[model samples]
Target: MRTFCVTGFGKKLKKHNDLLKIESKEDDNDEAKNLLVSPLDFDAVIVSGEHDITTGAIRLLLKNEIDLMILDHFGNPAGYILPCGKSKLIERHETQSRISSSKALCIAKAMCIASMINKISLLRSIQKNTGVDIETHIERIRKMTVQAESCLEINSLQGFECFSTNEYYSALMKIIPAEFNFTGRNRNPPMDPFNSLLGYGYGILYSKIRSAIVKAGLSPYYGVFHASYKNQEALVYDLIEEFRQPIVDRVVLTLIARKQVSSDDFNVTNEGCFFKNNFKKKYAGIILTRLEQEYTYENEKKTFSEIIEAQADILASAILETGKYSPFIYR
Candidate 1:
């Protein structure tokens, strides 16, 4: 299913016969600014910034079991409008709540290890492309993975994971073009263009994983790796580790390597680096396309979207004691 994103201010969505009609309130006479889409066109709608939707349109979406996601100014998910009868497995949530500490640690370690493995694989690809001798960094990350196998506490495992991530970023910085000014990973208000793209990409990834978790009948706030805090979807954070390197980082690095993006694509303000409207739209389209890209898994071709949904199911089965959980390791 596709995801329709609504951006900009003074926009309105309404039901027009069997189709959903979208138009700009600021210029109602402008046909070029209007769009008509079927409810079947997309399974989810992400509304960014200010917009208005008629009750009929909302009813149409709900009738089709479509999700409506609201994004804050930073492109982070503010909330969601799920259908009234969406699954809410109370038993599954109880099982999650009663998970033993040792099992939780096991899951956390597995996720971290899988994440490091994927990072190492990406680093190897980078090494091949840049011809940089980053064997030291690779070895260090490999060592961290080994240590993680025996890591006892969640905090300590995180420490090992963090160190490995630093080395991975360090290796990446060595090969990145000097013009990008990428030194390391930074977020919230990403200082550099690279980080600006990375942060936004992660935000989109978070939304995808969160949606997967919801569809899998799991609680996003209850997680194995990350502790729940106010308004935090800790499980989404946990699952995202295994994907950051393989999904978002790979795409961002390729964009840089091919010189497909430049400083003009971003807006550098005192607040931080942010994407220009044209580039943000294009980059988001690219990220969505990546989700749709297919790869071989279990001798069958599957999209990353399908794999993510499967991972969510795996997590649920683990919590329910029906099956084992293994994070997807990107090669």
Candidate 2:
């Protein structure tokens, strides 16, 4: 996938209009480095903006294919999910039979299974020639599978319902403290900044992303393990969720802990709350850089994007019923 970084002014993309478009600002880039997407094309598009962007600056995004999203100053989302209108633009697939939600879930379950199997395979790869304890790894898989199952729960009524704050942050509470500050004390009630409006903002973006992804017909289940819905794209959720525990959540906490990002990064107005451009750029940098960096998985190190795409592809294969179902549960 092509990664386009939009910096400076008057930056115009030199690539052919037909190729994939990925990684950009909410508006045009005057001097984007030339790239070739080839046959596969750009997988996704991320738009980062400092403040209010030109009213129609986002029009270019609506013309592409694949995922598109706009990030705000506070490291939150502002709900311009149409990164590429052509991607969300659907033509009736008269060639192949369309699957219902139940059918899709069945396939998605298999896809999740494939992802889990791949994880095990990758773990073995991580161990290298030294070898790993199969029994121990099996146990870990079992435990992680249980957690994945919970995330995959099919809550039709509530599955599609989104929260205003980052729900993943709430999920993390189960494993870690809702720290008032990254390394500071937690008050008795614990109802201050940690659980304040900032949290609420994260939740809003999370839900919007989920809603938009589902509406686009991309499986959210395949991406992350969140509450599942019948007609939603659960696959991407299956894929992205793996990063949530250690990636997005950790970054947010660290920002708070180091005081890199504070309440000042965000401002609430009657028009609705928004983050500062610098804040969005910071969070986006953190997320992208973290994802690009290598981390140990199953005792072996790999880039975050590698594992993420693997999970997503596994779901794609499963939906196609190319193999059995599986789930991805990280250790």
Candidate 3:
């Protein structure tokens, strides 16, 4: 699926006949050029920064069944305009509520195992490339996987999951530069540059997964592993587990390794460490590019973005008892 991204400020989208007339300005004093695009050409349009969309253009997008994604200044999805009239909404919610405990446990275990496998894969890859030995952490996670498989309850499974996550971050700390001062995974105000980039990237991924869940007509508040709490998108949290190590972690590490980002690009405030405003746009671009990268999936190449949507649909089918659910494991 094609996704067109509109960035910068003072951008405008207007519907003209069978096309969308896009006007973009880099600065307020500059006269920008207008470009025409067909709504049929892309599956989604992402708007970042300050932009204007005419009512006619909104109608055109809606008529074409195109998703309209609005991104915040930091590139996290603020909101989305998805095609409406989803069928079986009541049935889907009812099925979700009635999912068997055994099935939920099974699904949750699969998700944790997938996450562990991805973590091991990443650690091994990093070790191989950087000549860093994290075999102890890797072995610990391998053992944790066996323990996780035997878990009879979600809480126990989560314990094993948490152990593996700590091991993964500890392994990363060994390889990440000392200047970054990464001391393991901490969030809700990440304390180090490494974690700052990680939190931001994960925020972007979270929004994408949440949008996929919404498009699949499943309630994000209901989940197999993550307990539903007030205002929590538990299912999104649950599903994001499988992709975190492979996507956001990989992206952040790659940026640091390649020197695409450095300590200077971030600032530590009383709130927490964070990327400077200038670096956020560049980091967001890299994350989006990674999402668009193609990888083998079920014998065919599919972008991570496509895979996310497919996984959401698969999960919905499983919850509705129309199909079986499988967690995504990155190679």
Q: Could you say which candidate leads in lDDT?
A: 1
Which parts of model 1 are misplaced by more than 4 Å? 25-32, 87-91, 228-231
What 10-residue stretch in candidate 3 is worst by lDDT? 83-92
Which candidate, 1 or 3, has the higher TM-score? 1
Candidate 2 per-residue lDDT over residues 138-256, each given as its tens digit? 44554554444444443421232222112322333332333433222122222344433334333333433443444434544343233343454444344443344344545555565
TM-score of 2: 0.49
Instruction: Supply candidate 2's per-residue lDDT for 249.
Output: 49
Better of 2 and 3 by TM-score: 3
With candidate 3 superimposed using the best TM-score fit, by how many Å does residue 196's alpha carbon deviate from the native? 3.3
User: Which digits, one per residue and each the tens of the lDDT, describe model 3 over residues 1-331?
Assistant: 5567666667789998989998766554324368899988886787767889998998898889887878664445577777675322444687787889888898889899999999999999999999999999999999999888889899999889888888888888899998899888777767878887887777677777877887788888788888644567789989999999888989988878998888898788787886665576577778778989999999999999999999998988887675778999998
Ranking of candidates on lDDT, top first: 1, 3, 2
Residue pairs with backbone atoms closer than 3 Å in model 1 (clashes): none
Show how many residue pairs clash in every candidate, following the order shown.
0, 52, 0
Descending-TM-score candidate ranking: 1, 3, 2
lDDT of 1 by residue, 30-62 (tens): 344778989887787877667899999998998
Which residue runs of candidate 3 sit more than 4 Å off their true CA positions? 6-37, 47-57, 71-77, 86-90, 274-278
